[model samples]
Target: MAAAVFLVVVVVGIVSAVVAMSHRSPVVNVLSLVVTLFCVAASYALLGAEFLAAAQILIYAGAILVLFLFVVMLLNAPEEQRPKEPRPFQRAVGLLLALLAGVGGVAVLIGIEVVAPAARVSGDARAIGRLLVGPYIFAFEFISVVLLAALVGALVLVKRKH
Candidate 1:
């Protein structure tokens, strides 16, 4: 069923995102991130948001991820080195924090109520464009400026003298 596939894709995305963070090598992390993004695109497709799915793949997975890999290779980032042995106190603190997070997540899940939205085929390109340029125009422009600023900042940082 579509629901089952969507669930699987979302699960894969979440798991890959976590695994990406845990990776020591930057290349592996980026690769896992790509997988996570692809899973997100897959879920968007399952939801019938074909435009969103294409944007996810083209923008995040294609452009942004390629840019990340280019920067990584250009900078020649080294693999992270871990201590051969873990510290007892650090392990205890990590476990405590993880347990606390797990408990908080469970509590939040139990407390939240699900409110389903009315069904609409608002995923069409024309509908999405109209929504973006209509009432949401200011928000859309603001986000574009923010992303542009971020891109400029990233370029500046990457080109900075050591």
Candidate 2:
């Protein structure tokens, strides 16, 4: 079932993201993050959001992950340094958050009911393109320009001397 597959992919994505954070090696972390991203795309596709799936893969998995890897390599980062034990307060906060998240997840899972959506031209590229180019053209263009500016700003910040 699509619902089951979506649930599995979501679980996998969350696990991979956690694993990515735990990994000491930058390359392994990046790969784990890519796996998480791919899982996200898979879940999107399962939900019939093809455009979102493609955007997830192409933007996060392709561009952003590659950029992270490049930055890692350029910096020649060593294995991540970590304290053997977290501070007591930090550990308590982490535990509290984890417990709250687990409880919330269980509540959501219990509350979920599968229902089919009404038939529609979901993820139709033509329809999306028409909307983007028609009523929302200016907003779309503005967002693109803002994203481009942010990218340039990040590059400038990274290259700047302290």
Candidate 3:
């Protein structure tokens, strides 16, 4: 039953993500992304990582989706104004990339089944904390600095616009 549910969640996530990517309307895309994120959170819950699941719902579905909506509103993007005909060259390239992605996804699924127990132990917060404070400490600090810069840059942009 768990396996069946997991399969269903995976399918929903994939379908929603594809919708999010392929939609022309910014609002539709953002809502679709939120659905995809919700599916991911549900999958995490089914997999016994309640903390991760909650974080996914709270941080991604709540905060990130709100951020995406804010960006869409701030941009004041126009509605879909697509060309009447799709380019064959671009279609061919897109198909090729999609095929490659499918193959890569399958490989990843198989690899997950064979991953060492130690790698699978990342479901716990302490393990994640250790990773952040250990080998990934530099990356953690770097991202904080980057985020700070981004916030300052956004403030500067707003000030200039006023």
The best candidate by lDDT is 1
Best by TM-score: 1
Tens-digit lDDT track of model 3 for 1-162:
988888898999999999998889999999999999989898888766777888899999899899989999999899888767769998999899999999999999988866554534446677667888999999999999999999999888879542
Clashes of each: 0, 0, 0
Residue-level lDDT tens digits of model 1 in 117-150: 6685658789899899999999998998999999
Question: Which ten residues in a row are the worst by lDDT in model 3?
Answer: 113-122
**Distance from true location, Cα of 115 in model 1, Å:** 4.6
lDDT (Cα atoms) of all candidates against the true structure: 0.90, 0.89, 0.88
Candidate 1, TM-score vs. the true structure?
Answer: 0.79
Cα deviation of 79 in candidate 3 (Å)? Answer: 1.6
Model 2 / residue 52 / CA error / Å: 2.2
Better of 2 and 3 by lDDT: 2
Clashing pairs in 2: none
Q: How accurate is candidate 3 locally (lDDT)?
A: 0.88
C-alpha RMSD of candidate 2? 3.2
Error of 1 at 71 (Å): 1.2
